[model samples]
Target: MTEKALTIITQREDLPQLFGKRIENQAAIEEIISKIEFESRSITFDIETKDGQATCRSLAAKIASAKSALDKAGKAKKDEYTVTTKLIDADRNLAKSRLQALQDEIRQPLTELEQREAQRKAQHEANLAALGFVNIQAHDHVGSDLVKERIVFLENTVIDDSWEEYKSQALEVKDNALRILRPELERVKKREDEQAELARLRAEQAQREQQEREERIAREATAKAKADAERQAQQIAQESERKEREAKEREARLIAEKESAELRAKQQAEDAAKREREAIEAERLEAERLEAKRQANKKHRDAIFIAAKDDLVAGGVDEEVAKQVIKLIHENKISNVTIKF
Candidate 1:
């Protein structure tokens, strides 16, 4: 029987869904049992006569189907469609009997699997209970909302009345349990409390750092803006100064040009005046020179005329005047002249 049990255990472990489906079917039967609502005084035979036999038969048929599927899977070779010699090698009745024996053998391992599942659930609850202590300690913290960055930890579930009340009303239970369990529960609770405190402190520090970083960034931006404004102002001032200097230089150039024009005009006027004076002085000097030449020519002509008259008066065709007169008397009865005086 033990050997057979081991064999069925191995088979069920090898094919868990076959057994899992069977268990699910059993749970459905229990659900049906709950729905019937039998009084305590009710007899078993009455229920069995109506629904129990039918349910058992249905279960048997399903079991048979499961066995057939297992047999087929076992007979299947890894690379071929043909059954292996393990089944073909056995007597036909013996193989069928061995397959049938597996159903009865399935009970114990399934119970053990349930037990292990229960233990796993218990451990999970214990861990949750310990974490609940941390949650309770965190109630005192002001900004726990900020600290809880991840998903919310608590969720609700429905159970049987007794278990349901225990979950819904865990506070009274925890307090009582803490009193009895003493140092163990206390230690776990204290550890979680310490962790929550540490998390809170770390969150505060991070907030401070974020604020400081923002302040620094703002200061740098302000400084850069101020510097840019100052540079623009200086540029504007320089441009204005440059324009002013250009205007002043233009003014100076215009003044210089005007002064040069005036000087040139004055020099031309002076030159023209000097030329006119020279022309007038030259005309006067020419008129004086012509008058002096005319006067000297008249004096020379007068002197020549006087000398000619005297010569004519002093001598005619004669050498002596008395002789010339005697000649004249002899020719006519005119008076004679004195001889030589």
Candidate 2:
């Protein structure tokens, strides 16, 4: 009987281009396996040859031979898978190393150039700030006629890598600005000083005028007080002279009234004495006249009695009876009777 071989062909299209050669090597191994003589599913050999049936022992021998061929094919496929995976890992590692080296080479010069540019920009800004000319549009005073040309020149200038040119131009503009500002500052100070001096002089003049006005008021008050005192003294002197003249006139009138009263008392005393003397003389004359009348009446009465007595005696014729009738007649015992002889 001719011997037949069992083989398996491995096909893989998913592998990378770098591992495509490994697929050929795997194909050669598959050819070797196909040439091997074994009892398998693809290769057929009869265990019972022209006999009625086969016993269990012959079937066991055929199964053992088929198992050995299957084990060899599985081992070959496992070995191929392991070696191909290792080759792909080595290729990936080589590619990563090459890419890292290329990146380092390209970036080194670019980094150095960037660092230098940053440094130059910082130096330019610092120099402009020191000159006080940064953001020039914000300071309109820099464009004044005093330093306009110099300021405009500095503003238009560009800053290169050389620091010396920028510094020299900025210092020149600063000097020009100071030169213009110094004289104006001095002029303002001089005007303020002159105004202050004028104010002080005016204050002194006002004070002097006020002092003179006060002195004049005081002198006028003193003169008015003296005049009032002199007028009061003259009034007092005139009042005293009037009182003295009134006292002297009253004393003279009292002396004249006293002498007149004494003369009136003497005249009244003389009139009283004359009236007493006249009354005494009239009383003495009345006493003498009454005495003479009493004497004459007595004589007349005696004669009448004697005659009547004689007539009675002659009629009767008795002397004694005649005496008695005469006596009765003298005594006036008989009334309204005449004696007849």
Number of the predicted model whose lDDT against the real structure is largest: 2
lDDT of each: 0.56, 0.58
Which 10 consecutive residues of model 1 have the lowest summed lDDT? 149-158
The C-alpha TM-scores of every prediction are 0.23, 0.22
Residue-level lDDT tens digits of model 2 in 1-341: 11333222222222122222346457433443344333233334455664313534544555555446555556666678889999999999999999888887899799789889887867766766655543433443333343444455555655444765566755665565446444434444455566668878888987888887788778877887787778777777777777777777767777776777667667667766776776676667666666676666556655665666666676774777776766665556778754442
Clashing pairs in 1: none
lDDT of 1 by residue, 136-239 (tens): 33343324342232113322222234343345455554454444434444454666689889999999999999999999999999999999999999999999
Q: List where candidate 2 sits over 4 angstroms from the true fold.
A: 1-262, 303-341
**How much does candidate 2 score in TM-score?**
0.22
Superposing every Cα of model 2 onto the true structure, what RMSD results? 46.0
